[model samples]
Target: MDKNEKSKPSYNQDIIKIIQARYGYSQDYIRKSIRGDRTGIICIMIKDEYIRLNNEALKVIESQLYKL
Candidate 1:
């Protein structure tokens, strides 16, 4: 792996898949969020951007919001 690849933390694929499938978010977005980017999928909900979300996405967003 390259230095950049080695420096980035690895996230759980299962959780990423769950979030992506439920939120319709791209893998890149999910990966960024997992790596501490706050402007990922949660921003869609916060800004009320009219994106459709699955049940799990709603739950995940709620949980994340509480952490803030």
Candidate 2:
């Protein structure tokens, strides 16, 4: 299938919970950030840092985010 037609990965709740537990970030904050909502400055910073450290993770997250 073409890139546009390819099925995107859905949000993995287990991964989300793991991230939340490890980073101590609230689920609401993460969800909002993924949805491109304006979150706290710290939340944005943490998200950026996470993306920087894990490029593959960012891809999954972005895929899920865009699916929302």
Candidate 3:
């Protein structure tokens, strides 16, 4: 089987872990937030923004927002 077909059942778990790691959220919280999530848009947004952020500026911004 191809990769997508072989991993279909584990996709949700994989997504959950990725979100949790990135946001420092618990697995349960991520699961609930994404229960009806559409097309992984939230995850994609987060990832895209993450890539665009500079390490130093991101730290400053996060600090200002009390994110760190």
Candidate 4:
């Protein structure tokens, strides 16, 4: 993705609201490396390099946003 595209939001509260309202809840689960904690929510901190490196993953995210 380009710089402008990368500037867009991915995992945030607004998206979370839309997700819950539309899909009800996430079926996918993620296990965090930290202390063996698991969460249905996908967390992303702004300005994180991983967000830029794995931007292709955002396609599904963008598609879901279109449903809102």
Candidate 5:
């Protein structure tokens, strides 16, 4: 990713922690799932959550930029 871009939204962050807790999975597994190393329901759910959170965060950043 470019330096100006945020890091991956699902790694070493509260978002992953929260999801891990809810799904009873390890952080590493979650990361792997997000990185597309794994598959199945959990992977699908995590991918969806990651995308939703990432988009929500971007929208917030965009609105803040517009206000400034």
Candidate 6:
């Protein structure tokens, strides 16, 4: 799979809103930042958060697989 495009179990507004609420940024700005449409300390922070959430989701999936 492409590094840029994540597979299923993707993120949604709930996760985005979590970051927005925590960091005090607009949902549009956070979405742009995650999409690599912008750059800056704030953008970097947003991207990092997105990656963190993605990884967390992956771990949950992995654990479910192991339960089989």
Model 6 spans > 4 angstroms off: 1-10
Which 10-residue window of candidate 6 scores lowest in summed lDDT? Answer: 2-11
Write down the TM-score of every candidate: 0.46, 0.42, 0.35, 0.24, 0.68, 0.70
lDDT of 5 by residue, 1-68 (tens): 66787676435377778787788888888888888899999798997897777678779889999999
lDDT ranking, high to low = 6, 5, 2, 1, 3, 4
Native-to-model Cα distance after best TM-score fit, residue 1 in candidate 6, in Å: 30
Tens-digit lDDT string for candidate 3 (1-68): 66555442223455456656878867655544444443476656654543444344556777999954
11-45, model 1: which lDDT tens digit per residue?
Answer: 55566676667788787876665445656458545
Model 1 CA deviation exceeding 4 Å by range: 1-6, 38-68
* lDDT per residue as tens, model 6, 1-68: 66797564345777898898899989888888998889999899899988898788779989999999
Ranking by TM-score: 6, 5, 1, 2, 3, 4
Model 5 lDDT at residue 51 = 70
**Each model's C-alpha lDDT?**
0.59, 0.67, 0.54, 0.39, 0.80, 0.85
Scored by Cα lDDT, where does model 6 land?
0.85
Off by over 4 Å in 2: 1-10, 39-41, 45-68
State candidate 1's TM-score.
0.46
Better of 1 and 2 by TM-score: 1
Stretches of candidate 3 exceeding 4 Å from the true structure: 1-11, 36-68
Q: Tens digit of lDDT per residue, candidate 4, span 1-68?
A: 66555453335444444434544444231112111244333332222323443454578779889999
Candidate with top lDDT is 6
- Model 5, position 54: C-alpha lDDT score: 69
TM-score of 4: 0.24
